[model samples]
Target: MDWGSTPHSSTMYIWHLEGLKKMDLRLRAFLAPLLFCLGFIPLWGIDIQALVQEQVKSAGLADQLVSVTNQMLEGAIDTGKNYQQVKQLDKLYQETKNLKAILNPNKGASKPTGLGAVFKKAIEPPVDLDKALNLTNALQKEVKNANQDGLDYSKILSVLNQLENSLQTALDLKSQWLDTRKAN
Candidate 1:
């Protein structure tokens, strides 16, 4: 039968049936994870190295941010050791990593938080700390782009809001680090 010349409803029914028959169990298994990932798309992707470079603005200085972040992270780890809160530091580190994933979804590890919880803290929403730094870097770019493009301020404000919580968390970590140093 010439399915193309059939009535619209009949055509759709035939196609649907054919499509279902063609779909194998293996295909369904593959599509299950694919659809699950597609459902969790983030708003924007960022480049971590570019962002660090932009924010710090120096030749070959992006590593400094990594060093600083690592130092601060280590300090947090030490604090955890002192307070028997190593769990907290581990949690913070994982969260920071998750934040980085959010900020730089492109370069960020594609491993979904699900079934990938083999880390310091295995029971929290995927938060990327690297992304926090990237967010700041991304905003710097956005501001420059906005100035060049004359985009509305509302978009900038929205980006700022998205990072507000992460920024606060970063600030809190800095403060704690500072206070710990002072105490030492």
Candidate 2:
């Protein structure tokens, strides 16, 4: 029953083993790069998140956004201005969040896929990079309308400046990411 007993069968068995060895080598060659990229995704997320946080803190929005919003809420302010501040702050926060979502999409939110996603994109329009910069374009006018004991329009402007810087950093990172993808 041993193939080695016959020269013809032994030769056939040797060829079969050689074929398997070649196939194993090819599979390893293909999987090495795939596995490396798979392992890289989580590391990329952490690094990108850290970079964003660092940029946000450096731009000065990390704490000021919250503190300014709190002070405006507690202090007495004109009703109309109060409402305006609320609206503007909400928009700023939402825009900031959306930018972050764009950066490392795999980490935070899951986007829709397939035909539904295409339809949504068609209706909503693509993300406007200029939108973040324009968020506080009217702050100078708001500052002129400020009064004491009301919303600190000057401080609001300052915090928004930080928001602008943070957004700019995000935009820059996104550009780099796009370039890398294109090159790859």
Candidate 3:
């Protein structure tokens, strides 16, 4: 019980006795897993945060919406295929534009036309306007609950797929409508 200096413990300290003893393999085996779990505890929070944030970062939920919206609007201004869909959706066009603006506040909402953006546009498989609109609305919902937990991204993604298909359908129908009118 004497920690420092005492007549009864003058030869050696009590703490040193543990170092002199042989540790059991059973204890070492059990402690390894426990120590690893303890060591990993701090990382769980970080990984969860990173996952949630990743789902909304560039190429994440938010960025995916941006890419899709750009395609919709550009298609509207260009070929007039799904121009009406872009004009009339579950949300307003201005709102979609505003939400896309928040992709990178530091960049002042300028459109992403860089090489990476171009490559992504080229490589990204077809995907939605209403679903794109839903994501835009979710992003602007509260700016706090703008993640997977607060948003039904699966449904949004599903709707995105539906939207893509619908656009393709519209183009097919229009092309067919025009074919019937070809004067030969």
Candidate 4:
């Protein structure tokens, strides 16, 4: 015996397909925010600066580590002695490039050692204040070394701006974390 669809059953099946499609769309819409909250997407106070710094230090490229940190601090300041602007994507790109040693005082074979390799390392989150300070001091050394002839005032300014921006971002993160906690 053949089980065939009646006219009424065919119409019901078409409606069921349409309903499934609508349900699929609605399900996607509902999941968007849920996934975002679970960190699949960015939320308020997301700090890319911290992520950059973590990667820089983990690479242990030493020289690039310092340069990147300095640039982050400086970029923060340039953003209006404010922290949010420090993580500006353009500024981050410029500093990341500098940290990677793509732009350097030396040319070709003369380029600073380990600059490129540093970026290859995966970033690790800071474990303590001592580690953070060590990173800061190392960055200072790189600036001093790079400026033996005369400091690049422009570079200094940019770094200062980035630093300020990073600090602001950190503060913003803290505030948001607190707010979330309170709400919860």
Instruction: Highest lDDT: give the candidate number.
Output: 2
Comparing 1 and 4 on TM-score, the stronger one: 4
Residue-by-residue lDDT tens digits, candidate 1, 85-146: 33433443454444444544444334565556455236435334445556555544544443
What clash count goes with each model? 10, 0, 0, 23
Q: Can you give the TM-score per candidate against the true fold?
A: 0.25, 0.47, 0.31, 0.29
| TM-score, cand. 3 vs. native | 0.31
What digit string (tens of lDDT, one per residue) describes model 3 on residues 1-184?
5546677574565545655553556678889999999997776555444433432342244445545545545544565444344453223334545544443333332446779678655754333334444554454442333233222334435434543443344344445545755799
Q: Rank by TM-score, descending?
A: 2, 3, 4, 1
Q: What order do candidates take by lDDT, descending? A: 2, 4, 1, 3
5: Cα error in model 3, Å: 27
Q: Residue by residue across 11-130, what tens digits does model 2's lDDT show?
A: 898899999999999999999999999998987675467545745453346345546655664453335455656666555445444444433234333467999777755765333445
Q: Which stretches of candidate 1 lie over 4 Å from their true place?
A: 1-131, 147-153, 161-165, 177-184
Scored against the true structure, residue 12 in model 1 reaches a CA lDDT of: 92
Error of 1 at 134 (Å): 5.2
* Error of model 3, residue 143, in angstroms: 22
Please identify model 4 stretches exceeding 4 Å from their true place: 1-5, 35-40, 43-127, 131-184
Best by TM-score: 2
